[model samples]
Target: MEADKVKEACAVVAMRCKQDVAQYIYYALRALQHRGQEASGIAVYSGGLKVKKGVGLVSDVMGPEDMDKLSGKVGIGHNYYSIKVSRPENIQPQSLKTGIGDIAIAHNGIIVNSQLIIAQLKKEGKLFLLESEEEAFIMRLTDTIRATDDIAKSIKTVCKELIGSYAFALLVNDRVFAIRDPYGIRPLCLGKLPDGKGFIAASESVALDVLGAEFIRDVMPGEAVEITEDGFKSINIGASINRAHCFFEWVYFARADSVIDGMSVYEARKRIGWRLAKEAPAIADVVMPIPDSGRAHAYGYALGSGIKMNEGLMKNRYIHRTFIMPTQDAREISVREKMNPVRAVVEGKRVVIVDDSIVRGTTMKKIVKMLRDAGATEVHVRIGSPPLISPCYLGIDMTNRDQFIADHRSIDDIRKEIGSDSLAYITIEGLVEALNFEKENLCLGCVTGEYPVNIPGERRRFQQTLEGFT
Candidate 1:
C-alpha cells in the first residue's frame, strides 16, 4: 500500500468495431488506468492510422477534442509506466509507415532480446526513429510485414526470433492483431463486443467489462488473434514448452474485479489472506488493510482469524501511486500525503496491517510510524505474498535486487528496519496453495530465484554485481 511497492509495466487495449472506436478505447484505457499512469496514448485506423499521445494521465493527455480527432473503426490504446527515464517519444502506441500501409503498436512487458533484434534489423538496413525499446521492436515487425504479406505469419516469424515477455496489440491499417508471448509472462484476454459487431483484446478482462463486451477467454500463451470484418481468428506462435504466467498478476498488478487465465484475482487474494491467517496468525484486536490493494486480503484475513475488519486507513483518491513516482524523495512525500490513519479505529488497539507485498521497506517504515503516531498500541504487519528475494526481469519493475529488504535482511531485521512490532510474510508454499495451481504453472522466480526463461550469463553476473553478492 506504500508508494514503494512494485510497479506494473504497462497496459494495452485494442478494439475492432463497426462504429468509431476512439471513445471506446478511451473508456477502456480509463478502466485499465491503474495498471500504468506515467503516459497514455491511442491509435485508430480510419483510413490510415491517426495517433494522439502525450506524457500525462489519461484524462490530461486525451481530452474531448483529442478524442474527436482520433476517429476510427479499429484502434489500439496504451498506458505506460517507465522503469527508466520518462521521455515524450517513448509514449506509445508507437506507429510507423510501411510500403503496404501504416502500422501502429501498443505493448506491455519487456522484450529482453530487443537489443539483439535491433542489431539484426540495422544489418538489414532497417532504420529506427524512436528511442523506446517497444518502438524499435515494432519497427522489426515492419520489416517482417515487408518480407511477408501476411500479418500473423510475420508476427510468428519475428516472435520466434525474440525472447522475453510481451503482450501486443498492433494495428496495420484497418486490421487489428493481438499477440501474447510464448511463456505468457504477462496477461492478455479476448472478448466480443455487444451484438457481435466487434472484437476486443486487453491486458485484463476489466477493460472488456467497461465496454459491455462479453468475456470470451484468455489469449493463450504463444497465440496471435487477428480481428477482421469476418470475426476473430488465432494461431499459436508461442514456445512448445509449459506456460509460466507471472504470479504477481494475482498478488498485486491486476484489479480485484478482473480475471486472468480462468482465475479470479479477487478470489486469489482472498485465498492468500485466508491461508496467511492460518500460516501466520497475529493476535490483534482489529484487522485492517493498508487501503486499496490490501482490502480484499484483509477481509479474508479477518474472516479466517475471527477478527473484525475495519477501515483504519483513509487513502487520497487523487494522488498518484507512490511506487510510480519519479524520485525516492517524491515517493517518500507521497507516502505521507497518500494515506492517513483513522485514529478512531486504531487508537489504543493492537492492529494487524495487511499489505500485498514489500519492496524497499522505506515506505513501510513510514506507514508504521503513521499508525503509532495515531495511537495504536501495537502494529503487526502481515504481507499477503512471500518476501521478494530476487528481481523480476519479465516486466514488473523490481529489477534492482539491492532495493529488496528481504534479500538483504532477515524477518527480524526487516521488522526492526520497518519499525513494526511484528512482521510476517506468506510462505511460498502458502502462496502457491492459495492459487490452487501446480507450482510449475506459475512464475515464482522473484521468490525462488529460479527463472523459467534463460537469462544470459553476463546479465546474471551484472545483477549479482549490483546486489553485491558476486
Candidate 2:
C-alpha cells in the first residue's frame, strides 16, 4: 500500500491549463487516496486525451517525470481497488466509442441491478471487453447519449434505468461531466481551484481543501453536471426528496475535517457518542475509545455519560491503517504493532471500547485479546453503528458476506466469539433520531437494507435476514 495516502477507494478530476494537469491530478489523488489504494490511474484530454493506468499509487503509478509526459487541458483520475469487479480488468476511465464520439469515464459508487443491465446489453449484442459493473454503466450512458445529442437528457434516461448508487464522472470529447445517483448514496463534491481555471470532481471535499479549491456544493442527488470550455451546467433527473447520503460516511469512512450537508463529520460522530451514552448508559469507571475515528465519539460519550475519559490504549501512530493491508498476516502484524494497552489506566478496571463497527469479528477479537492481556478486569465493547451485514457495492470493499460476522451471527453469538464481557450496537432507530430525521438526506442501506436506491449486488453475496434485528 502507498505510505502517504490512507484511502482505499475514490476518483478525482479537473480541467484547464496554467497549472500542470497531470501534476494537479496527482495532488487531487493524494487527498482522495482514502477511497481506494489497490490501483491508481489518471487520464488527460489535451489535444486528444492521453491516459496512464496501472496497479500502484499516484506517486508510484505516476511521478513528476510521468506528469510531464501527459499534457492535457482537461483531465480525470481515479484511485480504486474496484469493489464490484475485483478483477483489475473491470476498473475505470474506460475509453469507449459511441455514435457521438470517443469518451473516457471515471466513476465512484455502484450499479445495483448490474446483472439485469448487462443481460439487456448482451441481448443487444454489444461486444463488451470489460464486464465490470462500472463498464456496463459507461456503455449504457454512451449508448443513450449518442442517440439523444442532449447530454443531460441522456443522463436522465440512463439514471432511470439504473438501480444502484453512483457518483459518475466522464471526460467526453474534451469536455467533462459528472452524475450523482438518485439517492446520492455516495458523495460527489465540486470545487474550484484558487485560480478558477477549472472545477474538481471529487468523492470528498477534503481533496478540494488540499488543492486550495474553494468548496463548491455537493453534487445534489439525481443531478448531472457538465464542465466544458464554455462553462458548467447542472440538471436533475430523479426524486430529490428520497436522497440518502451514506450514513457510514459519518460513522467511519469520511475524514473528520469534511463537512457534508453543512455538518462536520467529527461533530456528527461526537453527537453519536452523546446519544449512545443516553441510550445505553453504563456504570463503567472510565470511557476509552478504540483509537483513531473513535476518539471524537469517545469524547462525546464521556461527556454525555459523565464518565472520566482515559487514554486506556496507547496507539502506535507510526503504524499504517491495518484495513489497507492486502494480506491477513500483514494486517495482524500491523494491528499488534500499532496498538498496546496502557496498564496504568486499564489494569483491574472495567473498560469500554467504542468502535465504528464490527465486521468479520476478527479485528474486535484481536482488540479484546489485547485489552485482556493488559490486565483489564472486564472489557465492554460498544459499536458506534449497527452491524454491517450488507456488502457496500457503491464504493466500500465490504463485499464478501462470508467475511461479515453480523450477517450470519446474532448479537449474543458475536459477543461470545469476540470474548468481550458485553457488547452493544447502536440502534438503527436511534440513528434516525440522532439525525433528527431532519430531512431525506441520509442513506441507511447498510443498517436498514432498504436502499433508497436499488442494489442488485445484494444477491451476489449472501441472502440473510437482518430486518427484525434492528
Best by lDDT: 1
- The ten-residue window of minimal lDDT in model 2 covers 461-470
Q: How many clashes in each structure? A: 2, 8
Best-performing candidate as measured by TM-score: 1
The C-alpha local distance difference test score for the whole of candidate 2 amounts to 0.73
User: Compared with the true structure, what per-residue lDDT tens digits does model 2 show for residues 1-470?
Assistant: 12211133566565554555777778888887767766777788766768787776667787777788787777888887654435666556667665676677777766767888889999999878867666676688788876877777877887778776777777776777777877677788887878656777777888888888888688887788886544458877764454577788877777788776566888888888888888777778788987776887788789889988998877777766346578877866776777778888998888888877777777678888888888888888887887877666566666556667788788899999999988888888776666554434576755655555445433221222323111
| TM values, all candidates | 0.92, 0.87
Off by over 4 Å in 2: 1-9, 14-18, 83-86, 97-99, 229-231, 317-334, 408-410, 436-440, 455-470
Candidate 1 versus the native: TM-score? 0.92
Candidate 1 per-residue C-alpha lDDT over 1-470 given as tens digits, one digit per residue, 9 for 90 to 100: 63677889889998889888898899999999988888999999987789999877799899889877988899999998884436577788988887778888998988877788778777878777764667676676777788887778888888877677889998888889888987788999988888866889999999999999999999988888997775679887855356678889998999999999999999999999999899989889999998898998999899889989999999998876435569877755777788899999989999999989989888789989999999999999999989999888888878867989999689999999999999999999999999987776788888888876667642321122212211
Query: What TM-score does candidate 2 reach?
Result: 0.87
> What clash pairs does model 1 have?
3-323, 222-238
